[model samples]
Target: MLQTSPRCSLYLVTPLLSAAAANAFGEIFAEALEAAPVACALVRFVSGSEAHAAAIVAPLLRPARSADCALLIENDVRAAARLGADGVHVAGAGEDLAEAIKRLKPDRIVGAGSLSTRDEAMTAGEMGADYVMFGEPRGGAQTTGLASLVSLTERVAWWAEVFETPCVAFAQTIEAAGTLADAGADFVALGDAVWAASSPAAAVRDAQSVITRAGVGVP
Candidate 1:
């Protein structure tokens, strides 16, 4: 189980780092971590060579490590083992959650994502998922719009009331981050909004502010 404080925190996702942008992206990511209380980071590679992605992720891991943020590779167990990542995030029901637990257990975090239903999320918990993520973009676009945000917040609130397993609610905007926190998310995951902001660090700081507000007066 991934024990976290009652207060919600941030979980950052990379903005598709190509091999050429590795070094630069590393620098930016490190700065973002310094700007807020980020609980974890999911290294997402939309489309690229896994080998190249690993090569880039290797150096970036140092920043996340230094900041005490758990670093999880997206959808690749082998790469997690090879890169010595903190854990692996298996997306969708298609991935073998059992096998992933078998490989990374007793040490690394094995989180589940792309879960659309309560049944799938419950199954993930039963399979020993360290945590289950909700509201994350499926097929890369659905979660960005406004409709998904409302649905995600409701799910986070529902899960928080009913389950002990940690829930990470992906927020497409800083406003959504605060909403999720108030609704009782353990961690709010930030996506393109952070990277697209004029100042990524400032964006994180802003998100942190929202979460802090939500934390107040909540018993």
Candidate 2:
């Protein structure tokens, strides 16, 4: 059975970080966690070996656990397993996703993203993904504009209404966080909207407020 929450919550995504950058962002990440309740955090790394990724994940693990946040490693199932992360966020609903589920299910989270069609999302859910993420930029491309946002919101609504698995909707801006939450996202993912802000902690607080207000009485 899939787990569900009473209301939408914040899901944070890190910018692609190198080892040095990851070290620097650790403090900021802790501050954001302190500011509000974050459901999960995806630690993305610049293209590198698993060892390099592990190095970055090791330090942040403590802070994430301290804050009661699920720490997910992006696109590196082995690293996640070896490092004892909460789970792995696979980028597509293909063999990679299936393998992650096979390897990590019943013990760890295995979320699927980069789904381009409703069928793909359904496939991910059927394959036992912990959650299906929509509106995340593919290949590091930026997804912006009102049209894209509308499409994402619609997708999230469709999933929330029809599926048991949770849906994560990526918001391009802080303002969009509430919109996504009101549209029925199980989790509103904030990337640049929080990391790029002047104060990430404050941004997290703002996101929390909006999500709380929008999620009021949402079934």
Candidate 3:
């Protein structure tokens, strides 16, 4: 199997909070990212550019030569490559993921998102998904919020046990992120929980502390 470098200190999912959440979200995310001292900072972090979100975020990030950035889309793997994102997250709900992988080749890190189904997990693994992102895909139909959480997380667990693809678990809040680490998630995805904070630096520290307290080793 192919190897992924490993997880970073802050894995941030972008475009958080509609208008209300957007006001300061970007600044907070950048602030938190910078505060996580580069001396001990393991990595630059991960961001999802579903639509043209990458264009908006890329400028804000202006990632260093060493920074790591991923663009997670509903299905467009090619767009990710075009944008020069470090990785691409493909959802199982889309068309055959293998085809997407073929289009992307060895450049983009391909990850498949799941909501916890055995078949879906196996299919992703068989398709050679570089990483398996288990956790409910957030910010879609609002009604599915609560249910998507457990379903996605459980599937992440299953994928880890059954597939070669490593898993990243998404948590709605910092506390929940810690829970995911406890559950053995390889990497924890933090959305607005930390990004929307008044002090993104403090938020990163809070989440990292919780992750450490939960006994999950950071890469």
Candidate 4:
């Protein structure tokens, strides 16, 4: 589970990486972490066997831990266990999530994403997900535009108002981080908004500024 924070925090999500890219990204990730207080980071890899994925993820462990950032593996529980990642993030709120929780609970964080409805989100919370993410693009697609952002903000507002379980809201751009924070998300996830920037670390600083500004009087 995420540590409680009085204000919304940053959650970093890497672009899908290959083993060769992981080493370079490790440097970039460390730079971004220095820009602000990130609550956690989820590392996604290009399709590969679990052992291969674990090999790709291994080099990142030290950087993440040195920064006190919880590192999460996307969708592979076995790799996460093998690499001793801080947690695993299951893409759907179903048996995958349930099994992840059953296998790793009390020792690892299991977050749920790809929820399409209130019912699914509720089910994930009931099953003890460490956090439920909203607004993440499905299947490596580009970020959906304004309509999805509006819907995401609304869902985040509703969840913050009604639920005790922590919520993570994906922000497609640095500016959107503020909107989600104001909507009461406990953490705002940054993907393309950070990694696509010319200076990923600078983008992270900008995002932290926006979230801080939005958090004033947010309660």
Candidate 5:
């Protein structure tokens, strides 16, 4: 069995916003995160095509960070450690994940992102991932409906139980987030709904309340 960290946490996905507004959006999240209770902040640094994304994101990983993904460089792993970020997640298959695990400790949270198929998710689990980030269930076209959400959640939950690997639920809206939480998601990852709201902080606060009300509050 792959070793799982005690800090397998409540992962919060960063809200999507205009790249031109990324820094300011980050600040909004940073402030809300500082106040809102959560286990970690998952930033998509290297997910982009920037040379310094890791250097830019590592500082955010330290104090207020619990889990994370996409450390840009081998050097960035050191930064993650320095920042006291519990985990450094990797995305994709045959990705240089081994190098990351080798660089960080074995128990560090090294998550795999965007596994759209069971085979893909299982492969990630077998390779010793701390968690497998199942892609969003329903957010596009006819896919964005209550039925789709329920169906996808059931499938993801089944996989999580079978593999004993935690599932990270990414919701596009507030109601969707609540549904995921109530559906027994281990960690709920919400974005756009809160950050892009007219009142980012207020929206997040309401989200915090809803998550708590749904009995999904992180310890």
Candidate 6:
């Protein structure tokens, strides 16, 4: 999270984008984006029928696109393509990075996550991934799980120093955002830390302020 490197932006992720939750969540997401600049927002659906998940994402497209925020669907290429999403976040190392790229290539984004080691991360970069994320919650990927703060900071700093592929450091708290910034993370990802706040928009503003204070410029 070095303040001296390329400017870092926020990468937002929804708690769960289910059909029953889209309308209410969309309102909060729109408010957050309006309050601060975001690199992208992932419409995450944990577990559900594909049809149901697709229906859930349908209502969220308008708000994110209108704000000019890239909206990515988590771990679902079919939904990303069919729903006209900006891209796809291929969670965990178990997923096929190459196939995902091929499926969505030359147009949509394909970010690789669930990286627990430098080799896996570098491999993703070599595979033509748009970005590689670390410290994100894992979905039972044996290769790697979320790393500790010390480990995450080191990983981000290492990647920022050596690689051009942008790295995202998942920040569970405002303080963690600053720490990641100092470590040279290319982006700070906010998940439960924002949505669980009493005011989601205010939370984003606060997160942005933290990143700025750390000497990391925001886009």
* Top model number, lDDT: 4
Between candidates 4 and 6, the one scoring higher on lDDT is 4
C-alpha lDDT of candidate 4 relative to the true structure: 0.87
Candidate 6, residues 148-191: lDDT per residue as tens digits? 67777888889989998888888877778888987888889888
Candidate 3 root-mean-square deviation in Å: 5.8
The collision pairs in model 6 are: 1-180, 1-181, 1-182, 1-183, 1-184, 1-185, 2-183, 2-184
**What is the per-residue lDDT of model 1 for residues 28-133, given as tens digits with 9 covering 90 to 100?**
8999999987889998775756778677787689999899899988888888888889888997555577878999997899999878688888899888899989
lDDT of each: 0.83, 0.85, 0.55, 0.87, 0.56, 0.79
Q: Order the numbered candidates by TM-score, best leading.
A: 4, 2, 1, 6, 3, 5
Clashing pairs in 3: 116-155
Put down candidate 4 lDDT per residue, 45-74, tens digits, no spaces.
886645478567877888888889999999
lDDT tens digits, residue span 79-183, model 5: 456545566656653555666667675645677665656677778778777666654422322232223666657755676557677766666677766666666
Clashing pairs in 1: none
* Alpha-carbon RMSD, each predicted model: 2.4, 2.7, 5.8, 2.4, 5.6, 3.9
Top candidate (TM-score): 4
Off by over 4 Å in 1: 138-140, 143-147, 215-219
**lDDT digits (tens) for residues 24-84 of candidate 3:** 5545545666654221111122244234445443543443223333434445565556656
lDDT of 1: 0.83
Candidate rank order under lDDT: 4, 2, 1, 6, 5, 3
